[model samples]
Target: MRNSPLHGLRVVEIGTMLAAPFATHILSQLGAEVIKVEPPAGDPTRSLVRGGPSGTFIAYSHGKKSACIDLSTPGGRAALHKLLAQSHALVHNLAPKAARKLGVGREECAALNPELVYCHIRGYAAGPQQDDLASNPVAEAATGVMEGNRINGRPSRLGPSYHDQFAGAYAVIGMLAALLQAKTGAADRHVEVGLYETGLHVAARDLVGVQLKTQLLGRAEREPHGEFAMPGYGAYLTADERWLYLLMLTDGHWLKFCQALDLPQAADPGLARLKDRKKAREQVEELVGRAIGALPFDAAVARLKAAGVGCTEVLPLERVLEAPQAQSPGKLREVAFRGLQFQVPEFPRHPDADDAPATLPPAALGQHTREVLEQAGLSAAECAALLDSGAVRAVDPAGFAWAPVRATS
Candidate 1:
């Protein structure tokens, strides 16, 4: 957008995997120019078995320029230093020591640019396990997120990458706070976000639920029944075997539900109130299930809603893609890469740029290395030497040109 909040900001993202890259991609979506520095192997995500671009990679890597630089080499480190010197921010998710070893640690980066907003993401907090590599399920498991998500009495991890994305979003919030400080003429600052901590934060509600069940409900000896324990707050199967979720948490909703079903048992004094209904949970659930199961899916959903109970048919992933809500403007953005077109959710939105957000394709590996180096004032021969020495890699840049004048470093 012409007046995007992050316009003219420059970020150097020395990130691997999902978290850090996703944070930087958020910045890019908000109109920052994010230069994603990858190792020679190209972030390891490029090798996924996907038919085209890896979904995980594309989701987090979109709208950023990629520069392949082998940080193990002196030339590569020097180039990164130059970029950081000109960048407004630097973000990475490398292990603590690995970041320091590459000379991109918080202190090193601050020394390069005193006003830079630096963000570091790691697997855990600053403890003995701080330096261990962390990915999605690892942090999810370590933080007891999996344990809290019980399915049929067995602990299960979420299939989606929750910890990684949560950490990334947390890092983005930190970056934005630091950027605000810098804009006010503050010195460079560092923000650290850990996947383990994010996992804990994400599962905080469940943790609270567990405590309430044990302490308040006095169910310490019994594993508290889940949402389905509430008569009106559960799923029901229709005649066609499709499921619909019903949420009747309040007395008003419960009364409406009972009135809609016209259940003679609901009029009983013992079952009129929610507290009493809890005592007859099985009977209520059975009644609700039978009432719902006698109808088709649509009829079941309509009945529940007509009764003032919030309800929706459980949608599979494929059905969700076809839903009208998914087709709403600004919900998804169309983007193209290498002549292939697809849609991704438009996110990291701004109040001002709601209608004019950029939908640029992700950069090809090393697609902007030469362009960035040239903008950094490197001679063509110097750029050639770096590429030839295997210190850096780049595409021809064919028609791409980027400016280095608004250096963030």
Candidate 2:
């Protein structure tokens, strides 16, 4: 973390929920000093996750400072303005009108600090439905992700905030690029990311293929390729009902697959070409399926891999954490926060890094209010007045600094 690219930089974040917060979380990991500005009532998520310090809140918010400022009040707005002037970047996930009201909109932030990289995250990009409110589920539904993820003819929303996470990543990318450009010349400091648009980008290939092929070429939509779209490329069940997926991309691969599985019937010259094998896809797939079904899962996986075949076990989602792949050395490390310890995965492999990068504990509401206002150069008297006037939320001494749960409990 001390050697990260964004080291020594400070970012001011104002928003609720996922998109905006997630962006700053990434920035924080990249070594930026992120100060999250929240309402006096605190981020809605503080009470959201089983009455929070919920897993979601702690995961995204740890390793940052919190200043519970009430944007509705004069003092709180003043505090944010001061912070913006002293920070390198400002981020918010509010609608345009809401941002304007809170004085954190693009124009407002740019006016405060022309060099500031201001990032605005929202539901949609410039569109007929630009002002429409959206969240993770809404973005998925609007971009056909839910429909694309259909099961038994029912469109299902993803379990995670996949689109929101992508939007957050995009925001970070835009902000970093803007900062880089600023170093060279006059640059557009305002960066924007929209959730619905991000969802479309994630499915760029499908969007282009599905729309262009059908609309311009007058071709029907292709049959759903269950896994890999080819006969030799899909999932098969083993004798113990464990699933494994295979990928045979070429005629050579088909030959290899045949030899690996020891299938004398499939070694004929008539089935050498992928096109020919695809024509007999049912027969080809069935042959491989029976061969695999004759052995236990561990044996089948080992045998296929030893033959240089591309394959992997279809581990159930619930058992993913138990998989050896996810537990490899340096993949995850134990971090304590919100009275619980979790094995969080690390990102950005750095050659110089000898240990997993360190992250601070999640801050309680206004945990750093007094500390940050002072750092922003506000006098003690001024901070006291704001706290007294309800411009800032009170803090809990015990919860402000997170501690791990005791083992005895």
Candidate 3:
């Protein structure tokens, strides 16, 4: 832990669902001590669909201490205040109304601890649509990801929840930048990250192409048909029934690719330039596809490598996971939870590391109520009283539902 970059810093995570929790999970991987505050019922994802802790919850909450507190109660709110007073950062994805209702709104937290970095992750940034609620799929549509990554002119959602993952990554980046600013004598700041904005950023190259081509080139990029306009810039299936993608971004690569694949027409002066090849795109694709498709996957990849053309097999996720590099300490990690061992993807080890340390086990809901509160300077008796009063809770497989609490006289 001492070798990790964020070793001494502490973070308090207050949220439901994936985005904000994932962001803090990344921070935890970097050695920040993260205390996850959940409603007494636990995050909805914990029991999504068929019930029991879901894989998504385990994946995102690994290495965090869970504290179950009903923020609607005075005792619960007081517990949060105590936790915030000693924490360096707070992360949440609640809507404006929900945030204020819980008293962890940006202004509210700022008043509690001005030096704290308050990171907010939301479906959208500030705008007329700021209040418009969206889930991962909605964000995918809103940011054009579903519409842009298409097959046969029909929009399709990608296999993974990319928008949520991107939003989480952006939140981590924003918080890091804020921490850097604070290191230079600037006050701690509020960092905002939105799923829609992250989607746009992730699809930057496509968006930039639209701007440049329509404004400058006087043409729109052709609707994609599971391939690029450039013959060598997309995937092709081999004779052995395996798929591989090829890339030849420069003239030099094009020449080498043609020679290596034994395509005679590439030498014709009529197909000398990129514009000329694009003009005969169908013909070029036919020639290139036939040349590569005639070979087995490995043979095709070998020839492309020898010719210095970039090529890779279009493998499924499980196959890719079996790659040697993916099994390295920095990429894949083993974690134990409830007597079961699970292999999880890990962030690259921080630059300050000398060895790969074991990752923290994922916490069960409200598993750390007493320990975390004790760290926040609560006596054992006070924590017990809070639990007895229905303000704080310990892990209960039966689960607890959150109800609005009436203030005591």
Off by over 4 Å in 3: 151-154, 217-226, 349-357, 397-409
Between candidates 1 and 3, the TM-score winner: 3
lDDT of 3 at 15: 74
Task: Give the runs in model 1 whose Cα sits over 4 Å from its true position.
Answer: 50-52, 150-154, 208-229, 265-269, 348-355, 396-409
Q: List the residue pairs that clash in candidate 1.
A: 85-409, 86-407, 86-408, 86-409, 87-408, 87-409, 88-408
lDDT of each: 0.79, 0.81, 0.82
Cα misplacement distance, residue 366 of candidate 2 (Å): 2.0
In candidate 3, what are the lDDT values of residues 1-409, reduced to their tens digit? 6877788889999978888888988898888988999997788877774455567777888888999999999999999999998899999989867888989988988988998999988878888878767778787787666876776777877867768878888899899999999989898589998777787788788778787889887887645554566756788899998988888666677788888878886588777778788888888778878887799998888887988888888888668878777776567778786656777887776545564435778777898988999999899999999999999998875453324356899
Worst 10 residues of 2 by lDDT: 397-406
Worst 10 residues of 1 by lDDT: 396-405
Question: Model 3: which ten-residue window has the lowest total lDDT?
Answer: 397-406
lDDT tens digits, residue span 225-275, model 1: 445456768788989999988887876777777777676765677877888
